[model samples]
Target: MKAEGLKIILSGPSGSGKGTIVRELIKKEHFILSVSATTRLPRQGEQDGVHYFFKTKEEFETMIKDDELLEYAQFCDNYYGTPKTFIEESVKNGKDVILEIEVQGALQVKAIYPEALFVFVMPPTLTELENRLVGRNTETPAVIAQRLARAKEEVAFYKEYDYVVINDSLEEAICDIETIVAAEKLRSSRFKQEIEKVWNA
Candidate 1:
C-alpha cells in the first residue's frame, strides 16, 4: 500500500480546550504528537524534548537564521518553534503529525503546506473562554486577561481552517475529532489506490 500521513494543526485561544483535546486525540489515535521547541524554561514536571526542547536564546536565534524551523515566533519573552526535520520524517514514515501552534504560525504553515489539515477549536464565547483560563491556576490573573484579549484576535481567523470543531465537552469534542479522522481516511485521494488494488486483485 502507498501510505500517506497528514499534518494536522490545532489552534485556539488560551484555555479554549485545545490542550485537553490534543491529549485525548493522542491517547486514542496513532498520530505522532510533535513537541515544540522553546527558549523558555521548562515548567514543573516537564521533560526536555517531551514537553518542549528548552534551548538557549542563541541557539533559537541560530535556528531562525538557518531557516531550520517550520514556523517560529516570539511568545511572551521566549522564542518557540516547530523543527523542520522531525515533521518531514514523521510524514515520510506514514505517521500523522499533530502540531498545536498559534494562529500566526498556523497561517504560515498553511501557506507552506496547503495539504496540511487545519482545524480550529473554538470556545463558545469570550466570557466562557476567560472563565476557562482563570480556572487554570498556572497563570496570573493579569496574564489570563492578556491572553483572553489576544484570543479574540486569534479566534477571528477560525474561518481559514478546513474544519471547525467546538470544544464544548471534552468527550464530545473527541468524538468529533474521531469523525474527522475517519472521514479523512476515507477521502478518495487518501485510499483510492488501495481500493483499486483490491478490485484488481
Candidate 2:
C-alpha cells in the first residue's frame, strides 16, 4: 500500500527566509506548494489561479461561512485563506502539500489538522533579522521597525511548533527540512497499511 502524503505547515516571521527555503524545497522534493485564495485585488502581472485565487470580499466571506477555508486570516483589510478542497485532494493523491503562511494562519491550521507537521523557521539572531529587513531596501524605516517588532513577537511562538529550524545558513536550513520530511514519511503511523499487510501475511 502506498503511504499518504504529509501535510506540512511552514511558517516564520517576515525576515526569516522561509520563502527562499520553500522555493528550494520545491526544486528538490516532490512537494506541491498550496495556492492561497485572497480578497485582495491582483497586482500587475498577477494571475488568478497561479499567483492567488482572487475573490471578491463577498465571495470570501461566503466561503468562511460555509467552512470552505481550512484557515483564514485578515491582513491589511484583506482576507487570505487556504481553500480546503485543493489540499485535501492533493494529500489524498499522495502529494506532500506545503502551506507557507503566516504564524496566525498556521496556528489556525494546527487546530483543524493536528496530525500535520508544523515547522517554524527562525533567524540566527534578532539583530540579524533586522539587518536582513534593512538590507531589502524596499520598505521604509518605519515599516522595517514594525517588522522587527513583529519578529520579536513571532519568536515567542516557536515553542508552539513541532520543529524549529534556525536559518543561520540557507543550505543547512533546507537540509534540515528535507530531513524532517524524509523521517516523517517513515513514521509508523503513516505506514499503517503496509504494517497490517505484513502482519496478516
Candidate 3:
C-alpha cells in the first residue's frame, strides 16, 4: 500500500505571511494546496474548482448537513469550507494536503482529525505586524487597529497548535516549517510499517 500523505492545518494572524510561505513551499511539488469551497460569488479571474469550489447557499447547507466538509464557517454572509473528498483523494495519492485557514476553522479540524499536523505562524512582534498592516495601505487606521486587536486574541489560541514558527525572515520561516514537515513524516507512528520491514528483513 502506498503511504498516505500528511494532512497539514496551518493558521496565522493577518499580515503573518503564511500565504507567502505556502506559495513558496508548493514550489517543491510534493505539497498540494487544498482548494476551498465557498458560497460567495466568483470574483474576476477566479475559476470554479481552481480558486474555489463555488456553491449556492443551499448546496453549502447540504454539505454541512451531510458532513461532506471537513470544516466550514460563514463570513460576511458567505460560507466557506474545505471539501473532505479532495483532501482524502490527494493524501491517498501521496500528496501532502495543506489547509490554510483561520484559527477557529483550524481548531474545528483538530477536533476531528487529531492526527493532522497543526502549525501556527506568528509575526516577529506585534509592532512589526502593525507596521506590515500599515505598509499594505489597504485599510483605514481604524481597521488596522481592529486587526491588531484581533491578532492578539488569535495569538492566545496558538498554544493549541503542535508547532509555532515566527515569521522574522521569510526564508527562515519556510525552512522551519519544512523541517517540521520532515520531522512529522519521520514520526514513529508514521514509520510503523517500515519498522516491521526492517525487523522482518
Candidate 4:
C-alpha cells in the first residue's frame, strides 16, 4: 500500500531564512508548496492563483465564515490564510504539502491536524538574526528593532515544535530538513499497514 504524504508546517521568525528553505524543499520531487489566499492587492507581476489567491475583504470574510481556511490571520488590515481544500487534495494525491506560515497560524494548523509534522527554523544566535534583518536594507532602523523584539518572542515557541533546524548554513539547513522528512516517513505508525501485509504474506 502506498503511504499518504505528510502535511508539514514550517515556521520561523522574520529573518530565519525559512522562506529560502521552503523554496529549496519544493524543488524536490513529490513536495508541493501550499499557496496562501489574501485580501492584499497583488503587487506588480504577481498573478492571481499563482502568487496568491487574491480576494476582496468581503470574499475573504465569506471564506472565514464558511471555514474554508485551515488557518487565517489579519495583517496590515488584510487577511492571509491557507485554503484547506488545496492542502487536503495535495496530500491525498501523495504530495507532501509544505505550509510556510507564522508561528500563530502554524499552531492553529497543529490544532486542526495534530498528525502533521511541525518544524521551527532558527538562526544560530539572536545577534545573527538581527544582522540578517538589517542585511535586507528594506526596513528602517526602527522597523529592524521591532523585528528583533518579535524574534525574541517567536524564538521562545521553538519548544512547541517537533523539531528545530538552525539556519546558520543554507545548504546544511536544507539537508537537515530533508533528513527529517526521510525519517518521519519511516515512523512505525505510518507503515503499520505495510508491516501487517508483510507479516500476513
Candidate 5:
C-alpha cells in the first residue's frame, strides 16, 4: 500500500474540470492541497497564501536562487512556484499533499518523486472546454483566447502522465479520483514494511 503521505498531482487544460475535482476531493478525502506562490496579481477573491502566496518578482527570483522552491516557472509574464518546506512538513504530519501544478512542474516532481501519482484530467472535449472557460465570467475574450491556445499546448502533454481522467461528469470524475487514492493506499510498496510489522506484532 502507499504511505499515508503521498504527493498527488492533478493537471489539465485551463478550462478542464481539474480544479473542481481537486476541490471536491479535498472536501471529501484526506489530502492537503499545496498552495502555490506567485508573482502575478491576484484576481478577485484570490487570497494570498491561499490561492497563491503573492510575492514580488524579486522575491520569487530570490526563492529560486535559494533553492527554496521544488519547482517553478514563468507563464504569461508571471512567476509561480511551490515551496518545498510546507510539503515536507505536511508529509511528516501524515497528510498526503496534492499539488495542482502545471504539466512542466509535474514533470519535475516525477524526477524527485517517481512514485507520486500523476493524474491528467481532460474535459469531455475541446468544445466543452471552450464553453466552460466562457462560463467562468472572469477572463476577457482576449484572455480566453490566450488560455485556450495555452490549453491546447498543455493538453498535448497529457500522455506524459500515468493516468488520464476525463472530466465529463463531476460526480464520475470525483469518484474515479477517490478510487485512485484508495488503490494507491493499497500499493504493495506502501504496505510491505507495515505488513511485516503487523505479522511480527
Candidate 6:
C-alpha cells in the first residue's frame, strides 16, 4: 500500500490571509484543498461541491448527529463544517489534504484528529491585520473594529497550533508553508510501512 498522506489544517483570524496562502500552496500538485459544507444559501457564482457542499439545515443537522463532520461551527445562525469521509479517503490514497478553517473549527478538528498538522497563519502584527480589514473597504468602521477585536481574541489561540507562519510577505509565507508540508511528508512515521518493507526485503 502507498503511504498515507498528511492531513493539514491551516487556520487564522479574519484578515490573516489564509485564503491567499492556500490558493498559492495548492498551485503545487501534491496538495488537495478540502471543500467544506455549509447550511447557508450559495451566493452569486458559487457552485455546489466546487465552492461548498450546500446543505439544507436539516441535512446538515443530520450529518452532525451522525458524526459525519470532522469539525463544525455555527456562525451568525448558519452552520459550516468540514466533511470527514472524503478527506480521510484522499489521505489514504496518498494525497495531502488541506483544510482552511477558523480558530474554533480548527480546535474542534484538532480534538478529533490529534495527528493532523496544525498551522496558524498570523499577520505581521495586529495593526497590520486591522489595516488589511480596513483596506478591504467592504465593511463599516464599526464592523472593522469588531473584526479587529475578534482577531485579537483569535491570536490567543495561535500558540496551540504546531506551526505559526507570519504573513508579512506573501511569497515568504507561501514558501514557509510549502517547506512545512515538504518536511512533514518526509517525517519517519509517514513511511513506516515502506521502511519495514525495505528491511524485510
Which is the leading candidate under TM-score? 3
How do the residues 1-201 of candidate 6 rate in per-residue lDDT, one tens digit apiece? 355788999998888999998898888887889988999999999999888999999999999999999877899999998899879988988888999878887888888999999999989988899899989989999999998889889889988899999999999999998888788887888888888989999
Task: Give per-residue lDDT, candidate 6, residue 106.
Answer: 84
**Residues 57-166 of candidate 2: C-alpha lDDT, one tens digit per residue:** 99999999999999778999999988998888888998889999788877888889999999999999988998999999999999999998898888899887899999
Q: Which runs in model 3 stand beyond 4 Å of their true positions?
A: 39-45, 56-59, 74-78, 197-201
Off by over 4 Å in 1: 37-66, 73-80, 137-142, 191-201
Shift in Å, residue 94, candidate 2: 2.0
TM-score-based ranking, best first? 3, 4, 2, 6, 1, 5
lDDT of 5 by residue, 1-201 (tens): 336777888999887888888888788546779978899999999988778889999999999999999888899999988888878788767787899878887888889878888999999888898899999999999999998899899988988888889999999998898788778777887878789988989
**Would you list the clashing residue pairs of candidate 3?**
none
Error of 3 at 58 (Å): 5.0
List lDDT for all candidates, in order: 0.84, 0.90, 0.92, 0.92, 0.85, 0.89
Stretches of candidate 5 above 4 Å error? 37-66, 73-80, 137-143, 197-201
Off by over 4 Å in 6: 38-48, 54-62, 73-79
The TM-scores, one per candidate, come to 0.76, 0.86, 0.87, 0.86, 0.76, 0.85
**Predicted candidate 6, C-alpha RMSD:** 2.6
| RMSD (Å) per prediction | 3.7, 2.5, 2.4, 2.5, 3.9, 2.6
lDDT of 5: 0.85
lDDT for each residue of candidate 1 in 1-201, tens digit (9 for 90 to 100): 656767889998878898888877877546779977899998899999778889999999998999889887799999988888778888888777899888988898998888888999988778888888878778998898789889889888989998998888888887887788767766788777788889989
lDDT of 2 at 144: 94
Backbone atom clashes (below 3 Å) for every candidate:
0, 0, 0, 0, 4, 0
Better of 1 and 3 by TM-score: 3
